[model samples]
Target: MQYFPVFLNAQNLDCLVVGAGEVAARKVELLAKTPATIRVVAPQACQTIQAMAEQGLLKWIQREFDPGDIQGQQLIFVATDNHQLNCDISTLAKAANIPVNVVDNTELCSFITPSIVDRDPLLVALSSSGTAPVLLRYLRQKLESILPARLSELAKFSDKFRDKVKAHFNNVNQRRHFWEDVIEGDIAETVLAGDNQQAEQLIEQKLQQDEQTEAGCVYLVGAGPGDPDLLTFKALRLMQKADLVVYDRLVSKPILELVRRDAEKIYVGKKASLHSVPQNEINQLLVDAAKQGKRVVRLKGGDPYIFGRGGEEAETLVEQGISFQVVPGITAATGASTYAGIPLTHRDHAQSVVFSTGHLKDGSIDLDWPALARQRQTMVFYMGLTGLNVISQQLIKHGVAADMPVAVVQSATTDKQQVVTGTLMDIQQKASEANIQPPALIIVGTVVSLREKIG
Candidate 1:
C-alpha cells in the first residue's frame, strides 16, 4: 500500500485550503461534509466559496499566501494553480509536521485525498496512493452499486447497541460471539431491507437471546437462485453480519457482492469433475470459521436443503453443537419455473410438484423413475442437464407418456436464460439444439403446456 489509511479527528481541527478555483472548491465541498472548521485562503475566491463565506459557513482569507497561513493548522492544502506556491506550502507544512495536500501535484503533497464512497457513518476510502485515481474511482463506483444505502444507518444502529451488548454479556469471549450473531442477524438485515421497526425489534430480541445463551453460534445461508432479486429478505438479512462466507461455485456473482466487503470470502465452489474444495473440506471450513467466534455464512446456490447438500453441512454444525439456522431460498426449480413462465404446481394443471436431483454424489442418475413417472405431477429435475438423455428415456420407460410436454430452462433468472419446450421424447434433443446446460431446471408434466396460458 502506497498510503497509510487513517481517520483524522477533523472536528474542531483547522483545515486550510489555499485556492478557491473549481478544483479547490471541489476539495472544500468534500471537506465541508466533515465537522472540521475550514479556512480558504485565496486572492480570488469562487462564487460558491464566496457565498459560503458570506453566509458564515467558512472563514475566507482574501489575501496572498503568507508564511503565517501555515501556522496553528493541523492540516493544510495548497490547491493553487501556482506550482511554486504549492511547493512552498508543502515545505512549510512538512517542517511543521502537518499533513498537506497539494491538489494534483503529488510530488509536493505530504497527503492525498482518496476516491471515497461516502456512506456517512460507514465510509469506504479507496486510494491508489496517487498512482491511479481513475482506477480507484472506477472501483469506488462498483462498490457504491453493491453497497446498501442504509449501511450508514446500520452502522449507527450498531453504535447505539454497543454499550448494551457489552454490559449485558459480561464475558468478553461470550460478548464477542454475541456480536457476531447481532451483526449477521436480523438487526443488520432490517436496516438493509429498509425496515427500521423490525430491525429495532430484532436487535432487542438478539439482546435477549444473548442473555439466554452464554456463547452464540453461526448460520449457514443459502444465497438462493442466480438472481439477487430472488433472494429471501431473511437470507439477505443474515448476510450483513457475516464474518466469513464460504461460497459455492453455482452461487451468483451479484449475491456474493451483497456480502460485507470486509468479510472474508472463501471459495468452496465445486464443479462436476473438478472439486475446487471438497465437500468435507467445506464442512470443516464452516466449523472452523464459526469456532473462531465469527459469523459464518455458507452461501450456496438455490435452496440449501434442495440438492444443495445444506443438510450435510448442517449435520457438521450440529455435531459440533454450533448455533446455526437455515434460511431457505428460491431453489433453481422455483426460480426457473417463475422466470421461464412455468409454474411448479397449478391447481388446474397439477395437484403436486416434485423436486428431484438427477446426478448423485457419484455422478450417476440414481433415482426411482417408475414412482417419479407414475405420480403424474410436475417433476422439476435439478442438475439434469448432463443426464437429460437418460432422464427422458427413464421417464418414457416408466409409463410417463413419451409425448408428455417438457420444458428446459437454463441459467434461469439470469440475462442469458434460455427456455425450450418439447415432448419428453424430443426435449433432450431440443435442449441440446438450444445448448442448454447445468445450473438449470427441467419441468416434466402436462403443466408444461400451460406456459402459453401463463404467457
Candidate 2:
C-alpha cells in the first residue's frame, strides 16, 4: 500500500484552502461536509465560494497565500494554478506538522481525497493510492447502486439501541451476535423500507427476547437474469450475510461470486433431463441448513415466484415452521426481452403480455394454445428453447399467424447475449441454427418487429 487509509476528525480543526477557481470550489464543497472552520486565501474567488464566504460558512481572505497563512491550520488544501505557490504552502505546512492535499498533484499531497459513498454514519471510502483515481470512482459508482439510500437512517436508528443492547447482553460476543441478527433480519429490512418507528419497536422487542438461542432463517433471493447488476439491494444484503447459499444452475457465475466468501455453496441446479439435485432434496437442504441455526439463502435466477418453483420451497418451509423471506428479482422475460430490444408490450403493437413456461414436469409442452393465440398480446416463454417446435406448431394451429414476428434472446443482459429474430414459421429453425441454449427467452407478437428499429 502506498498510503495508509485513515479518517480525520475535522470537527475541531482549522482548514486552510489556497485557491478560488473550480478546483478550489470542489475542495471547499468537500470541506463543508465537515465541521471544521475553513479559511480560503485566493486573489479572486468563484461566485459559489464568494457566496459561501458571505454566508459565514467560511472565512475568505482576498489576497495571495502567504507562508504565515499555514501557521495555525491543522489541515491545508492547495489548489491554486501556480505550482510554485502550492509547493511553498505544502513545504510550510509540512514544516509545521500539518496535513496537506494538493489538488491533482499526487507527489505534493500529504493526504489524497478518496472517493466516498457517504451514508452519514455509514461511509464507504474507495482509493487507488492516487494510481487509479478513475478506477476508485468507478467502484464508488457500483457501490452506490448496491447500497440503499436509507442506509444512514438505518445506522442512526441502530445507534439509539447500542447502550440498551450492551446493558442487556453484558458479554461482548453476545451483544455482537444480537446486533448481527438485528442487522440481517426483519429489523434492518423494516428500517430500510422507511418504517423507522416499526424498526425501533422491532429492535426493542428483540432486545427483550432471549439472546442465548439463535434461530436460522432462509431468504429466497432472485439473482436476476445473468447480470449481477440486476440483483436487488435486499438480495445483495442477504447474500453477503448468509451462512450458507443454496443456488441454482440458472444463477450466473458473476452473481454467485458476490455470496459471502466463507459461506457454504450447494449447487441444486437442474438442466433439461438432468437434475443435479432434485427439488425436494433442495428444499430439504434449505430446511436442514436453517435448522442448524445458519442464515441460509436460496438463491435462484429470475423472479422466484415466476416459474422458478420458489412457491414450492416456500411451502416446504411453512410446513416445517421455518421462517423465510422472499426477495423478488427481475424475471428473465422482462430482463431478456428488454435487453434484446423486444418490448413485451408496446402501445402500438402489443397491448398486453402473457408469460408461459415451455418446459413441464412430464417432459410435455401443455399450454393454452387458444389463449396464447389471442391477438394484440405478446407471449414470453421461459425455458422454451427445447420446446420451440411444439410452441411454434401449437401457436400456428390455434388461429395464430405462422408469420408472426418472434425473437429469441439467449443469455440475456450478459456480454454473451444473442438475439435471434424470425417469424413464427421459421423461429424454431433460426433458434436451432443459432444454437440458442436454455435460459433463453422467446418473445412472440408484433412487438418482436420493434427489435429491428431499436436493437
Candidate 3:
C-alpha cells in the first residue's frame, strides 16, 4: 500500500525523462503508448531513443541534466546509472510537487511503475512495491496466458452500452448484476468472436426480458482458518458480490476486510456460553434480507459443515424456500495442525484422524472418551480450551495413558499463533500457565510428538 495504484489520464500530459540510456528508452516507449508529450534530456542518446526522436515521438534535448529541465513537467523519469543525479532530480521533483520515478531505487521514487497486462480498456496492473520484481514478472506472464486475447473487444462492446444499462437500473446493485451477467454470459463470448451485431442484439434482448425483480440468494461461504489465503476462489467471489454480510467470531479481521466495501455487515459471533445474536435470530435475519432481494453472504470460519452449524443454516434456508449455495473452506483441524507442524495423520505415527467439538450447545463435556482415547489415531478437539482439564481427565480415565502426547494451538495459521506441547496429564496445567485462550484446537495422540523432529 506504499504506492496507491491509479491510472493517471495521459491525454495532453507533460512528461520528462532525464536520461537517454537503454533503460530510459524503455520508459519513453511506455510513455509514448499514452497521448502524453514526452521530452528527454541527456548528454548522450541511445540508438532507440535517437530513432524515436527522429520519428517525432519525443523532444530530445542534447544536453546534461539541469534544474530548469523539470519545469512544467507533470511526471518525471530518471533511469541513469548516476545515483547522485537521480537523487538530485528526485529532490527537485518533490520540491516542485511533481510525481517522479527513479529506476531501481524505491526510496527515490514518488511512484513505482507496475507490470501491466494490457487488454486495452481492460488493463490489469500489479506491483510488489519495488520488492520481488522477478516474482511480479512471473505473475504477469501467468495473467497474460490466462486472459483472453480478445478481451479488449468485449470490454469495448460493454463500454458502448454502459450508459443505456445505467439508465435502466435505478438500484446500483441491479446495475452491477446486469453487467456481471452480460460480461460472463453469451454476449461477451459473441463479442470476443468479433460479432458486434449479434452481441448488440443479445444485450438488447436480455434487457427487454429482465425488468422483473431479481430473486435474492444467499452464499454460505467458509472464511477458512485464520489465514485469508486459505479462502477458496468461489468463497472470495461470493464475498465480493454480497449486498449484506453476516460473519462469526472465528472469522479473522483480514478476512472480513475482503467483504464488499459498502455491504452492510452484521456480527453474530458467539463466545463460550454466551450468544451475542441467537441462532434462530441469525437464521431469520438471513431470511428477511433475502426476501428484500439483497444478496446475502453468511461467512463462517473453517468448513461450514464441520461444527460451523452450516448444515443447520442450510436446513433453515431450505425450509423457508430460499436459494443458497455453499462454498467449502479449509477447516481448523487441517489448517491449524499443518501450520503448527503437527500433522493430523501420518503413515508411521497415526493412520487415522478424528475431529470433535470440545464445547457443545448444552455446555456439557460429555463425549465418547473410550473411542477418542484409543491409540494409533489422531484426535483434534475444536473450541476445547476452556474445558481442557475435563478433556484430559476423561481421556486418562477412559484408558488413555497419562503420558499420552498432546498439543494446544491458538489462533493457528496467523501471526498471533501460539503452540504448547506436553503430555495429556500436564497439558491442562501447561495451557493455563501459557494463558491460552479459546478458539484453540487441542491435538492428541503420537502426532504431537512429531513436532520435536519435523516442526
Winner by TM-score: 3
Which ranges of candidate 1 are over 4 A from the true structure?
1-216
Rank by lDDT, descending? 3, 2, 1
Tens digits of per-residue lDDT, candidate 1, 307-371, equal 88889989988998888898888788878888888877878778888889888888999898877
Per-model TM-score versus the true fold: 0.63, 0.62, 0.92
Which candidate model has the greater lDDT, 2 or 3?
Answer: 3
lDDT value, candidate 1, whole model: 0.83
**CA-RMSD of model 3:** 2.4
1-455 per-residue lDDT for model 2 (tens digits): 77898988888989999998888999899889889999999989999899999999999999987888888789999998899988888888888899999999988988998899999988898888888877888899999999999999889988988888888976553565688878878999999999999988888787777657567899999989989999999999889888889999889999999998877898888987789998899999999988877889999999999999999999999999999999999999989988888878988988899999888888789988899999999998888888898899999999889899999998999988999999989998888899888778898999989888996
Task: List the RMSD of every prediction in angstroms.
Answer: 8.7, 8.4, 2.4
lDDT: which is higher, 1 or 2?
A: 2
- TM-score, model 1 to reference: 0.63
Clashing residue pairs in candidate 3 (N, C-alpha, C atoms within 3 angstroms): none
Highest lDDT among the candidates is held by which one?
Answer: 3
lDDT of each: 0.83, 0.89, 0.92
